[model samples]
Target: MPQVQRVPMRAVKNVVLIAHDSRKQDLLDWVKYNRPVLREHRLFATGTTGALVQAQTDLPVTRFKSGPLGGDQQVGAKIAEGELDVLVFFWDPLEPQPHDPDVKALLRIAVLYNIPTACNRATADFLVASSLFHGEYERIVEDHAAKRQAWLAGQGRR
Candidate 1:
């Protein structure tokens, strides 16, 4: 039932980047301004967004396929598997997305996993400014042994 593995000092913070056509610029601006903070983490982005980020910022980016081509789900899978640390998805509210299901799934999974997520410029700013960005993160793994020992002791004669 536990979500993430309590990794207190990690070398890389797996961050996923996504942006609708209209919001691509927003993503770029944020990355441009916060490249220092972002550079310390490993970045993953979808298609053109990745190319753009790489071209504009100093951050290293691992690019997945385009969102419409399943990249969104790829990132979501990472979140579900606890491989992702944060998700900064700049979505265009006014325009309709072709990959609606993928977008919905990504949002749903992020919420389900209790991962830090930002859907717009303002939220992204807040997320980037959080002390957690520079501070250590504690990964909480399932304490299986502790639970089992406690159970055994509870049922013992002593």
Candidate 2:
């Protein structure tokens, strides 16, 4: 059986926001509409989007490098480190990104770590409106370290 833990998700979540060049306006507009909810949480974002969001919304956002320049990896590192609770990424599906592999890695890490992610405004809305949004919820996280230890033991390679 896989080990599991019931962690408390605070009423104020740690959220990362990112958007492609084409969807920056869309994300900004959505952020404006959801300011009340957003203000309650810790926010982070990539370079241009972060600056734009902070400028328009007046919400303090921790800024990272631009996505093409390593912002996606930065966010993925946060997820891997268990620092971010949710990811609200407004990626442009029609446009191919220069850092496409990085984008895929970010999404993959989010899922692997069981982080709540919103790829669109609709999903973001539902996420914020859900009963669990402001309350504690249980999520399953794989105990990879332990699993690796067990595998090493079984292989007699400890």
Candidate 3:
């Protein structure tokens, strides 16, 4: 079994919000409804979405480039660097995006880093309602480098 490490998370989480063009309104609604809970955390979003979120909810959000212009990659990099704590991406599954690959990579990195991610309103609501969201918590993640090294050593013996 791979070894695991526990990463401590502070009560004030760094959360990134994302939404496709078709789903921006839905995400806005969710954000507005949860403004109070979100006010306790740092918020981030892509260009248009961030503008809309800020304008609508009056919440301060750090804005990145538009997703097609590399915003998703920026978010993915942050996740890999352990800077982001949560992800709320309300993407339109039925629509095709020019930056689909970037979106996939973003989701992949989120899973790799073991961040709490929500793809829809229901999941977002559940995440916010969870007891862990309001307090300090430890995230357990496998030590991938060690596992790779072990596998490489075993290969040399074969």
Give the winner by TM-score: 3
Which 10 consecutive residues of model 2 have the lowest summed lDDT?
2-11
Ranking by TM-score: 3, 2, 1
- Score residue 127 of candidate 2 by CA lDDT: 92
Model 3 weakest lDDT span, ten residues long: 149-158
Encode model 2's per-residue lDDT on 21-113: one tens digit a residue: 999999999999999988989999999999999999999999999999999999999888878899999999999999999999999999989
- Cα lDDT tens digits for candidate 3, 1-158: 77998988899999999999999999999999999999999999999999999999999999999999999999999988888899999998999899999999999999988999999999999999999999999998889888888988989942
Better of 2 and 3 by lDDT: 3
CA error at residue 72 for candidate 1, angstroms: 0.4
Displacement of residue 107 (Cα, Å) in model 1 is 0.3
**Candidate 3 residue pairs that clash:** none
lDDT of 2 at 35: 95
Misplaced by over 4 Å in model 1 are 1-11, 139-158
Residue-level lDDT tens digits of model 1 in 1-158: 52234645354678889999898998898899888888888899999999999988756789999999989998988877778888999998788888897899989988766778899988988987877766667745555556677778989923
Ordered by lDDT, highest first, the candidates read 3, 2, 1
Task: For each candidate, give its TM-score against the true structure.
Answer: 0.80, 0.91, 0.96
